[model samples]
Target: MSRWFRVGALASVAFVLVVLGAALRPLVLPEAHTAASILNAVEIGFAQDMAAHHQQALIMVQRLDRGVDPTVLRLAQQLSDAQRIEIGTMLGWLRLADASPLSAHPMAWMHTDAATSQHHSNTSHANSDAMPGMATTAELDALAAARGHNAETLFLQLMFRHHQGGLAMARVADELLTSGPVKETARSMFQSQSQEAGVISVLLTQLGGQAPH
Candidate 1:
């Protein structure tokens, strides 16, 4: 009986040890590696570029705010708020990545000469205006002069183009950059803006308008 009691006690102690080991395994072991860091890098780049792009859109919307169309005014306000918040978030990612938000060459990370060439070609002609998705001095002036539904229509049209330009930039970021906060931000932007673009499309239809083909 004494020997049996000792054996049972040892068995109970071993069982407790096993349970303790299992409980502590997670704390002692390293987590599984993942692409989270890589995604973060993409996010940072996406944020920076998208912020700059949104800035242009904001400027255009501000010019149209003086018009009398309530719908346009409301939409402009929404765009301004959403983009401003997103810009701040992107800037934060830059800080996290130790990257400068104000790089000398904007959109340099894109590495696509085609985009740059297109921007330049559009502005090459003496009378040609700023690139598409960019507001020119004359176009802004015209938008400022307009009022009522015409102003609303114009604002929607310009904003639609601006969003499309941003979408393209986001796509490039998603494809190219790897690692860090930039990648994560890029993925987020890709998902979020894609959805937002759809919503914008719906709104355009409701307003008796359509996004450029």
Candidate 2:
């Protein structure tokens, strides 16, 4: 597609971020301590990391070819739109918690594995680009340069793997968070991404492309 479409989508996303910020401002208590107490490290970290993860999905969408099959384009658009709104929501939560939107230790909040702390310690310096389901700079570059059926197959494959990784984090969040808006959101993400991943798999198969390992 033309650069104009990408610019317009980004512009819309910025407006959404503004609206979400406004809506969440009232949720912050006058006392920063109270706000901090309400949101624990796990909640804050999940929001931070997931927002970054969702941003990548938008990048993939923006990089997609303009002349791909309508089915692929429509799915990409729908997923991107949903994830963009989710990114706004997550950033709003970070604002309420007075936490940085960027995670210093990506995936460190996940305590599912016994070696999680050790994993964080070992990978701390390089964790920024190491989040689950994140595309490498090379992979994104390839996606940006690809066109037509090649782009469609690659997008579906990459996105399928991306969704799998995201769903893993969501499941962990849902398991760890007892009750709260974040947990509810995590559960919602898990459900939605699961369904979306299944559709992506079907589409990838129809395109004669195997899901990436």
Candidate 3:
């Protein structure tokens, strides 16, 4: 990661985020304000929680060593770009709906859905700190301190587990919202994350690292 390459990468990321944000603004605004119906609790809650979930993903990508394998860097770039756009989209919905961008109760939204309740029964007492598959503070610290292959392996393992948790939330949202932009978004998230997780698994195996339990 020469200084020039680092600068170029940052610029590219910024350009993508700006372009995607502008393109998505119309899609998020129309239903939010022009539609006759209001956004339901499920929709609002999902946006809030999932946005926060995606924020952590950006952090994981940032903590990765820039000197790692090019393949790993490319994957990180893809995930970061996609999730940054999604975070913007989710925040747009929250702004239009007059909802908080952060969920005060985190996964508490899942409790309203019976299916989610049954599926996450073990997490009845979960909080933001207990969100499934979130890397602990110490874990993140370790990742930041790691270098080269070590950082790459740890990132893949952490991100793989993070996707699993977020995918669970998206699945619940998809099932709970019968028809809405939120449901559609959740379904898309599930599909995209599932594919990314698979690729991550293969990469982790190649790096001789097991996905974190």
Candidate 4:
């Protein structure tokens, strides 16, 4: 009799819990299973193109094969590290959104149309450059041929301009991307890159070099 009573009590508790779960399922399920927001063109474009942009930077920074001032070396190392991490972050967002990592036309998302594109200050990005502050193959070749101070100077100029261009992209991303992770990453980039640009400016002056026109 005692065993039967215990079994009956356990069954009754399980039945009540199941009933309670069914009653609350409607209230709890939707949010629990909510889908991630789809990443729009701007989000996808920024991720794809910016990853390429940073990859170029990584390439140039690595080209400083010869020794440089401690400061220059440290700056290049730090910038490259940050760029690598951010590239990874962008790629991660793209993966989550199930989007491609490369945009064939690159800046297609930055253009509304020819006339409308002119209204955008950064529309030069639509040209053959693919991105602002991107060093051409010729320029990268020049940088690779340089050594010591010349290489350091050229790298400084290139990276400073690159960061400036990246800041423009980050501003656009912060404005246009709806994804929280995308915007948050852009905002953080805006903050850090601005500060790094200031450091670059100081370094350039200390090196007796000026930004490329």
Return the top candidate by TM-score. Answer: 3
Residue range 10-69, candidate 2, lDDT tens digits: 999999999998888778535345333758888998899899999999999999998999
Candidate 4, 35-145: lDDT as tens digits? 756787777887998899889999999887458888899988999899999999889988988888888777666555442343256434545335777888888899888
- What TM-score, to 2 decimals, does candidate 4 have? 0.76
What residue pairs clash in candidate 2, if any at all? none
lDDT of 2 at 190: 94
The parts of candidate 4 lying over 4 Å away from their true place are: 1-37, 113-129
What overall lDDT goes with each candidate model? Answer: 0.66, 0.85, 0.85, 0.81
**lDDT at position 13, candidate 4:** 100
Q: Supply candidate 2's per-residue lDDT for 167.
A: 81
Report how far residue 166 has shifted in candidate 3, in Å: 0.8
The TM-score measured for candidate 3 stands at 0.78
In candidate 4, position 135 carries an lDDT of: 83
Put down candidate 3 lDDT per residue, 78-140, tens digits, no spaces.
999999999999999989888889878777767764745643743332453356667778999
lDDT of 2 at 118: 35
Candidate 3, residue 10: Cα displacement in angstroms equals 68
